[model samples]
Target: MSEKQEPSIWQGFKAFLMRGNVVDLAVAVVIGAAFTNIVNAVVKGIINPLVGAVGTQNLDHYSSCLSSSCEGDQGIQLMWGSVLGATLSFVITAAVVYFLMVLPMAKYLARLEARRKDQEKGTEATPEVIEVTELEVLKEIRNALVAQRGSGHDER
Candidate 1:
């Protein structure tokens, strides 16, 4: 018997590139990069100004000195404001992506799946039909067994 040949590296690479998920991932990456710019703009132009109403206009500048001499970067500085700003940006991005993109997509996919199942149900045999068919088959089998027993008794 002939042994099965392994796929070549080039063939495997070509298959990987041709897969639908690879294309989807590439599209997602491009869209994500574009979406990041929009989120960043919103955080800078809108959120920063709203926050600035109570504090500094820029979040990056807000920090605290941990040591006695913080002058000219001489002491340890805790840049908690930048961290807070980053957290805000992350929260905003996640909310927008979830509410606007992911939630809608999930709902649309669910509807499509439901419609597909309904269509399949219409095309395929129903459970009642299958049960009836099974009952008829069982009756035919019983009748055949009874006739066989009658013939056997006559032969004896």
Candidate 2:
């Protein structure tokens, strides 16, 4: 009798890391993180200045004091500008990802799927003539003999 050897923890971990999904997810996370900086910069350097053309230079400066004694001291401030800036950043990031990455990738995958289906259809369209095996012919003969015997019509 032979004993089965179980895989080690390190081997299991390596297998998990080598999986396509895991590697893809890791790459996505890294790229997303890197892309965030560019989005933030665009929002800060371009959009903020564009929006600032009408008023303050920086969005962070656009805050409303909530407390009554808000003058000359640090009071409760509603930072609506920062919120707007963050929202703009998020929107820009989403738009870039959708238009640049997601849309192109989806189109490519669709083309691949269509091509694969077309190839499958092309192959299926060409009908092949099926040849019966010897075993099938033998089976039919055996069935006929059995039926003839049951009906008491056997010829010696």
Candidate 3:
């Protein structure tokens, strides 16, 4: 008997690399990293300036003293502006990614799924159903019994 040969490590690695999902994920990761730079620039240039209208341009500088007096490093400080800026950036990035990529892709996939379902439904054959009355059923049973007797199977 011939034995089946298992695939080598290189063959498995090649298959993994050649997969569509892996390639797509790599492209997405690269694009996402580039997009992050643009988002960071926008936050730093435009959004930070807008935030500056309320306080300092650098949000890290906008801190409040927790103690009675803010003497050197003696008092505790709450950096609310930095937190606010970070939150704004996160919201902006999420909104842009959703509107530009995720939302549209989801909508397109939904449309494709709906079309596939419609095609499947259209191609399928409807089953034929015959409604047999109780009288017909009884007649069929009688005929079957007669046929069985005609078969000449005598069990003496």
Candidate 4:
């Protein structure tokens, strides 16, 4: 009696790591980290300066005290400016990724899918092709049966 053995843990791990999605995810994470630097630079260099025209250039410094007669580090300070700066950075990053990467890739994939469909349609068998194939199959079956019967008669 033979027993079937399950795959080892190492083999399963290797297979998981070798999947296309895992590699793609790793690449995306690396690229995203690199892209984040560019987005942060844009926000600090351009957006902060523009905002500085109205107030201070440093968003971290902008805050509001919620309590009256509050001394150093003794009040409810709402750092809305920093939140705004972070939000702007996120929005810029999203826009850049969508327009530059995601949108173009989607369009390219759509074009490829369309082309594939067109090729499939072009290669599809017509009624005449089907008829000819059926006829050939029938002829082969008839010849096979005839040969089988002739061999049986000889054996007898």
TM-score of each: 0.53, 0.50, 0.44, 0.50
Error of 2 at 140 (Å): 46
lDDT for position 64 in model 1: 95
Per-candidate Cα lDDT values, in order, are: 0.69, 0.66, 0.68, 0.67
1-156, model 2: which lDDT tens digit per residue? Answer: 998999999999999997655855686799889987876676677766766787665566677888876666667888898987677667866776666665665555445545656698884322322344446444655565567655774454
Note the residue pairs that clash in candidate 2.
none
In the range 55-145, model 4's lDDT, one tens digit per residue, is 7655776788898845788878889889986776678667766666656655554455455556888863222211123354445545666
* Candidate achieving higher lDDT, 1 or 3: 1
Candidate 2, overall lDDT? 0.66
Lowest lDDT 10-mer window, candidate 4?
Answer: 125-134
Clashes of each: 0, 0, 0, 0
CA shift at 84, candidate 4, in angstroms?
1.7
Task: Residues 1-156, candidate 3: write the lDDT tens digits.
Answer: 999999999999999997655855786799889988877776667766776797666556777899998878788889887997677768866776666665665555445545655688886333333344446554655565557655755753
The weakest ten consecutive residues by lDDT in model 1 span: 124-133
Candidate 3 residues lying further than 4 Å off, grouped into runs, are 1-28, 37-58, 71-74, 120-156
Model 3 lDDT, residue 22, Cα: 83
Which candidate ranks first by lDDT, i.e. highest? Answer: 1
